[model samples]
Target chain A: MSADAESRWPAVARDYVQAIADTKLLLGQRYGEWMLKGPNLEDDISGASNGQDEIGQVRQLFRLLEKQGVDRDWLETDREPAEYANAQPLDEEAEAWPTFMVQVALSDRAAWLLLDAIRHEDFTGMVQKMGEDEYFHLEHHDARLETLAVDQPEAVEAALERYFPGILAFIGPATYGAGEDPLVEADFTDRAVAEIRGAFREHYVDLFAGTDVTVPALTDDVPDPDEWDEKRRRSGDGHIDQRVADQLQGVTNREYVIE
Target chain B: MSANTAGTGTAGFSIGPEEDADEFEQELWATVDEVPDPHIPVSLVDMAMIYDIEVDAGEVTVTMTYPCMGCPAYDMIQDDVRAVLRTVRGVTDVTIEVTWDPVWSKDMLTDRAREELRDAGIGL
Candidate 1:
């Protein structure tokens, strides 16, 4: 790689790490909502453990970002929500537990595919380390899904209809520029959206195979890019979405303002 | 005078193997195993958290320990055990004695419990 390309590499890595970390932190916070309220004791315990795993992954990724001289507060502090580049699909709201479970199953499965691809990428050690954590998370979520599907089939079906579209949105746009301004420059060797979607679809099909739950078809086309941008902008107060903000209200019971 | 002094009464208690008492003791213990561990959500029997169960007449006592001394869920687990035991057919009253004498070790976990922990990525 040329000097310019080499210079670009760290930036690439930083952007990729930031985006992934943001996604993990956001989803982890969302999952944590189920800690005490899951439909059953087993599901509650599993959800808590899964949330812990995601937090662990976030911590590791944040540490790497810190080494790159990113301010710790930028990663940890409640910031303007618009800066959170988490894919919109993962951002959809679910009004019930079943819908929430479906949302989690789909998003977590997609995340596994994305992480697996990045893990094998020719990159610095940080991505690889983060990859290991994602593997554990993937397994954890999948196990919970299996338990739910076998033990409570009706709930799984209900969730699939309510949240599957959100899962599709989570794979993100077919082309970064096709939707919102590319949050970060696409750097991975496997940059094609179709390829990524196909991989995600394969995993989804296999997960639901032989089960009563029917895998919902992916949305035929990406949401209009302009509409997506408008949705993104209207998402919430500066750093996190309204839904998350509402969920996390009084989280620490202290007002936080960046100096 | 010596005869008069020997006339002072002596008090003694007699003890024997009470079969019903033994049966009750075993029954009480069997009930304790049905209680689930709050943190792991597994039966106390499977987790081996129930170290001993003793019964004396109507009063049942259980000796138990948690996965660790500072386990945050210790109180909840104790409450769960008490609740479960209170529902047993014969248990009139229940008491749990939380102890640290034989500290809980991973070795105490059943094969299935170990597998669950491993599946969760928690290494022993």
Candidate 2:
């Protein structure tokens, strides 16, 4: 992290953007793991395509953060685990296909919601393009969710219970209803964390309602956001996966790099 | 050189507001148009990927964009752009910059490119 970046952006802007980028980076890493491992050919190809889209979006966000004086290299690597602001759920690998789909569906929607709120002068175009890319991603995930509704309903429900609750906390539950978040006060984001979380919750609730799976009605504050860490933007436990840390280190093609 | 000879008619691809292309500019545009995208069958110019080409004295700068932010072959495309631009005469130095200010859309494709895509079994 550059000292200049710290001074260049308001704390809210820096924290908000970095967390989004970091989470997407980890999500992209998770997607890459499924490139050749998805159950079918279409899933395999879609996984690769979505993975590339995530990385591509990450690249764009990093470029923007770079212009704001954040060191692109540092953002990619060199930060400690706790220093990472990614959603905690991204810290783990999805063990099965349904779990992966559920995780992706939730993560992608959360990302889109945050990105939608953060759109400003220059970001307006990028956010719109991302919406286009995300449309297919969410569609694919929703299709998978419907299929899993019949095939692996239990797994899907478990994933929803496990992951969905943590997202708001990941996105900073501390800012929820605690008056206006600094980002909103600074006009960096159009919506408060509360509005974004509310939309996310409403979307999943309606989506789950349509599914045949008889899961409990989506609950709010499941993990209890009272312990949400303002700085880490999470519930104050866990860290990103080690493999993700290696990726953040940008350690591609070990044989190619000179010692 | 087949691509350049096949279509000397620069119907749609042109720089700035000037629809007219001088002989040298046409050659440079043709040089770029001939370098095929790794994924697509049509030339970059046919695909309308070349946004603008500015030539001043002996130096040239080519500004362009990929269809998506996450194009896996962007490096290859950029390198190919540099190599082809260097081959053109009156180009002493070459600079390439990719921008996302106006994100790429299918609307950016030319009529010829669209036809080629359809022929190649690609949808608009």
Candidate 3:
């Protein structure tokens, strides 16, 4: 950590970093659910590959957090559902390809923007490595959107409407009093929520305009901050589905002690 | 002509066999070509990941591309690159730089690699 980070900033920024790390891990878990179950082999390969990329990024962030004195074991395995700091949308099951696409389009891009904001900060090397992965994620999502627009326009539009509000939480509350949030005070993000929301809306519009799909209107899609837990960065009850948890846990059910 | 002191070698070690510049570079590349991709049987050179190789003053730098952007195998591939290339005589330092522009294409694969892929029933 740099002197600027260690000395001048409030402790909340560390929570923010933790939230970002958790979000990446959760997103990787969600993507892992679709590994070989996507609509086609190309999509299957993409899901598997993207899941690996996100997990790789999580490892990098976790290593950084360890350097900053966070406990690695607790972070990886011991946290309760409520203690998880990922965004609410990720808590939902990816039941359909459209739902997954919405996540890739809205939430992933928003997360990418946040990571990109800190690209030149004290964690430049790690952020740059993660950014390289985000580049491919965004590209793959864009390509998938184009495909869905032609094949399943209605489903895509419905997904956009369903998840756009929850995804808005990615940018945080729409407005903040001057010097109110430590995330901004610490220079961790370049834009406030409103600014990011505006830019994201424009980008979202441009993405679907060329096809028959209709982008969801953001006029009344604001997320309720009262529902949001500032510490956990989530707005809903429940963690991941039970099946998902069991599947994840089964990865290393048995281990041998080496003498 | 000079010792490889930049690495873990002990001090005052005698120099190894000498080679002309082109031959030395080819030797480094050959070493690189032998390191297989963890996910695939083919090597980075076979997968079109290696874009260029440069050698100067016993230091080797490789310019590389990912088979796919955000490849999870990035660190492993890079570590393998260093481990393999370091085995070459007279090499002291190894640096691997990644690039994305003009991105990797299947067309860049060597004939042997292409044959391996074809035999495995993998398509471009």
Best by DockQ: 2
DockQ of 3: 0.05
Off by over 4 Å in 2: A1-9, A36-39, A77-79, A177-179, A210-232, A247-252, A257-259, B1-31, B53-62, B83-97, B115-124
Q: Name the best candidate (by TM-score).
A: 2
Write down the TM-score for model 1: 0.52
B2-22, model 2: which lDDT tens digit per residue? 110112234554533246767
DockQ, per model, reads 0.01, 0.19, 0.05
Model 1 chain B weakest 10-residue run by lDDT: B1-10
- For each candidate, give the interface RMSD after superposing the true interface residues on Cα: 33.1, 14.0, 14.2
True contacts kept of 2: 0.31
Candidate 3 lDDT by residue in tens digits, A102-174 = 8765777877666665522445444555666777778989888888888888888888887777667656666
Model 1, span A62-104: residue lDDT tens = 6556756888866676555566656444565556676677676
The 10-residue segment of model 2 chain A with minimum total lDDT is A1-10
Interface CA root-mean-square deviation for model 3: 14.2
Residue B113 of model 3, lDDT score: 88
Q: Write the per-residue lDDT of candidate 2 for residues A1-259, one digit (tens) a residue.
A: 2344234557668777777887888878888888888889999898788888999888878877887778866887667777787877787888988888887777877877777777344363567667768888888887878778878878888888778666767655634543666777776677778767766777666666766565444345643667766656677678976666876676675567654
List clashing residue pairs in candidate 3: none
Clashes (N, CA, C under 3 Å) per candidate: 6, 0, 0
lDDT of 2: 0.73
Q: For residue A185, give model 3's deviation from the true position in Å.
A: 1.0
Q: Best to worst by TM-score, what's the order? A: 2, 3, 1
- Chain A structural similarity (TM-score) per candidate? 0.69, 0.87, 0.86
